[model samples]
Target: MTTELRNTEFHIRARDGAGAEEHGPYELDIDPGRTADGDAAPRYASLRHASLRILRLPPGGSHTFATGDSEWIVLPLNGGCTVAVGGDSDTPFELSGRKDVFSGVTDFAYVPRDAEVRISSAAGGRFALTGARCSRRLPARHGPASGVPVELRGTGNCSRQVNNFGAAGVFACDKLIAVEVLTPGGNWSSYPPHKHDECRPGEESELEEIYYFEIAPAHGSAGLGYQRVTPSGASSRTGRGTDVLAEVRSGDAVLIPDGWHGPSIAAPGHTMYYLNVMAGPGEERAWLICDHPDHGWIRDTWPDQPVDPRLPLYEAPDADLRPSLNETVEAGPRPSLYEAPDADPRRSPNEAVEASPRPPLHDAPDARPEAHPEDPEGDAR
Candidate 1:
């Protein structure tokens, strides 16, 4: 690693895939010009747990790997592909990838630990190889895009879309946990500043996360956004604290080792998408977090507001893209809208729910409504 690469912390800026300088063990761009052999050596390969790789292949191009101790998911960022495992012995599965992250949810294939696999695209594609060191050798399987749950979170400007494709409760994985978040132009996601860096048994889990971003711009223009991670005032057992504030562009990545990270903002006129890959030393693959007390009040204000109108960007086939009656009903005179646990510090974490009793039809105008009861922020991390 060059001196410059070594000095930069947390946020990993994009680099020419073919650059001669070695990228430190935190970022890698799999461009054809740079790594003609195959996927570049993962920058985080030496980190005891999580690893990520971006793969780009031309039509007819293929990449193969031996899964050693890490299980991986083949998530297409763009285009379709085929996943073949165990050579002729096992059947190969196909994934119908979307045109882009913003296009819609895409099917993904999971490759088990200690296996041999090959991934190839028919027309050409880019993929995110999200991997984590694990002990269980789970079966390789394909997840359909239609099955991925699409969640609309926050209200108005804080609203965003979350595709819970690989959430802990949604999909079974040994240690790898991954999800995608889409913030419309001028919106904010990952609000209330939360952290999962401590292993507090039933309270929180210690997890390291990577935020890989992609910004969508208007036609003939560029896109930009910002991300912030403030110190949570609690240091890791190693006595290190993470702090980062970055201007992120497409392909940029941010590493969250410890902190209250949030308020990922999409600049006006440009939508932002980010793939979150996480894992930790804990035995249970849970994504528990603690909201920053200072900003936790933001959740209470959501029930009084309406969700952004441009949600569910691309519904699965046979799904309705139109706004549901539930959303409209929640925005009305009823008080059923605010029931999120984070909205009230008095509410126990275990009290969070998907649906709760509808509040009285009428309440005082000063009533402080809680966030949506559906828990849109639950699996987003």
Candidate 2:
């Protein structure tokens, strides 16, 4: 690979985790200016069909925009909001968004091409606008958090959590396909090494993928993980390929132009989370892939192994409550949303909400010797 390609293939991108002002193709940090106009101007023009922008709105703040030739999803990274489509004739769809991406499944709204949208939050929130240029215009709609299908895949150390909210066949859209994955500490996800960059008749479809990462913090310190993408070795019409092995942290991202990506590994004590945004030049909106032949045998071994016990990390809103620090023993009704760190309502644009360290959902059996028995600080290795 050329030096330019090699250097850009897979790498960690750092920004003010509190919303930096930097702008580039690989990642777009939250920009306050765009939030006022409902504009998230992503920099990767080469992505061709798709773009992503994160919108941060203060409490009682609102933003409006028109979807000219692209379809989009108002995916909440934190807090809840009301998404109003059309003018004033229809009832706005309400999204009871979660506290943070790793907390649980969140409600989302879909805005079709050529439509007008207005998003307003009673208590302020941050939203991810995942967009794709499209030829077909689908209807404006809302997807309830309760309707998201949470799937647990792989087993043993390869286990992971998948929130198939915008998955193909599960949700309708013109050309956008998205999903969220959570891999627990010491586990590996996106495994069996797969590739969807080839457009085969029925086996595979070429798609450009963006992975937005968020690593769970440990000991009031930073968290870490790893990601790998290898060249497929097959020539393509675009003739693009890459080989990448990178150490990733919260707010980092990896762009896959053409390669076999896999083994998104979480560090021994920090869970890993990634939001996948995908779109392609294919005629149909489908997620098709061919597992790397060398590692395809891994799937056959899944049935023999048991899934990790700490799975199904977060469930549908209506499901029975899972054990959490926020839950109460004598409660009549559990708090439905995770609590975000306190934020001043009148803060300036440069200011960001304080990010509180997320306490572990359950205790791990493989904790280190130095780990505190009660006030656990993780492995710290």
lDDT of 1 by residue, 1-381 (tens): 332333255666675342435532223532112134544234432144666777777898888877777889889999999998884344387888989998878888888888888888889888888888789776677676655766666776888887877776555677988889999999888987899887987778888788889999797677988898876766444555666788888888877777888889999889999998888889877778888888888777766676676775765444323322224324443333112123434442223222446232122123225322222236224
Go through the candidates in order and give each one's C-alpha lDDT: 0.70, 0.67
TM-score of each: 0.77, 0.74
Clashes of 1: 2
| Per-residue alpha-carbon lDDT of candidate 2 for residues 1-381, written as tens digits (9 for 90 to 100) | 753455353443755332444432213532212334556334332355665666778889888877777788889988999998885344387788999877888988878888888889999977888877788765566677765767666777887887777776456666887888999999988887788777885667778787878898888868899888877965245565667787888877776767788879999878898888888888867677777889867765665666687887887666323232212211322212221112224221111111224333322123223221110110000
- TM accuracy, model 2: 0.74
For model 1, which pairs clash? 18-34, 25-43
lDDT of 2: 0.67
Count of residue pairs whose backbone atoms collide, per candidate: 2, 1
